[model samples]
Target: MTAPDPWAGILDPGETVLWQGRPDTRPQWAMLSPQRLTLGVVFIVAAALWGWQSAGLASAGGAMALLPWLAVPLLAVGLFNLAGHVLWDAFRRRCTWYTLTNRRAFIATDIPFRGKRLKSYPINRETILSFDESEPASIGFAFEPVPMKRSTRMKMVGFERIADGQTVFALMRGVQGKIERDFPIDPESLPR
Candidate 1:
């Protein structure tokens, strides 16, 4: 079999791993289908309008006369559709599974606009993992000691579509096992 990804190297630090999980992509994609469909509708409408104009429809000419009034809604719809596409791609590409290893943490993602960003964080400082059960399918991470606290949250980082929650959970547990095995720490013990 092929070797494990080099990105796993981040866990080599003296810290033990804690948790790792990715969102269910199937559900996420399903949730996004409406947006994709909306975009498709926009495309169809634009195409139909252009086609009617080309077909020498006098009514179409009259419709074009209302361009001033139509511009706002058309622009709004177009921008909304574009934003939806961007957001959908962003979630699919940029989100990732992460492991908090003994000495550090590792993140692998293919963000839409930003491209791929693979980062590892040392466990020396404080990092918090927050969950919203109301949206149980999602998870976020906050890295402290950073200048821009706003950017620290790992928003919408997981599979948008989840088929086997158990499998995902098991994988996370395994990562935790690796962290504990690789980095053992005794919180009660005194360093001095």
Candidate 2:
């Protein structure tokens, strides 16, 4: 008897599963650079000082008294910027699972409170595949633009920190090759 398909309705008909894995859950201390550390320290110190000064105004009535409470969120942000991000990153990696199929690459993350997310990036003939050849390498194929308050940053989405990177990369190349063979691009469509 054969095992039931884990991705029954998820994947399209005839889509073959190439690889499935999870990221290394080790603490990435290297993500906290000196600049980030300094910024975090500054934010923490400023928040603390503000909180202390505002505490004296606690005797005031109405919204004025609530000024002291504003520092709490700032302190939380500071803590997150400091070392919390490193721990959070590790935790997020632990919750994430990666799957590469003949058609697309999927990153499924299940975080508490935030719930589950399954994001897929297609691997077509035009898709640019890149490999970061490090210990427990990363294979990035797409750039997802993450929106911020003031600006947008491109986050590289891929199967990160996987032990078998080269093999997965080869499989992605095969997917692209198959796409090109199945649907060849017409030369007439080229822009002038």
In terms of TM-score, the best-performing candidate is 2
lDDT computed for candidate 2 = 0.92
Window of ten residues with lowest summed lDDT in model 2: 55-64
The alpha-carbon root-mean-square deviation between model 2 and the true structure, to one decimal in Å, is 3.0
Per-prediction CA RMSD (Å):
8.7, 3.0
Top candidate, metric lDDT:
2
Show where candidate 1 strays beyond 4 Å. Answer: 1-9, 29-43, 55-95, 110-116, 121-128, 134-136, 143-192
Model 1, residue 158: C-alpha shift (Å): 7.6
lDDT of 2 by residue, 17-135 (tens): 88999999999898988887888898899899989999888778688799888898888888988999999999999999999999999999999999999999999988988899898
The C-alpha lDDT values of all candidates are: 0.51, 0.92
Q: Relative to the unseen true structure, what is the C-alpha lDDT of residue 128 in candidate 2, on a scale of 0 to 100?
A: 88
TM-score of each: 0.42, 0.84
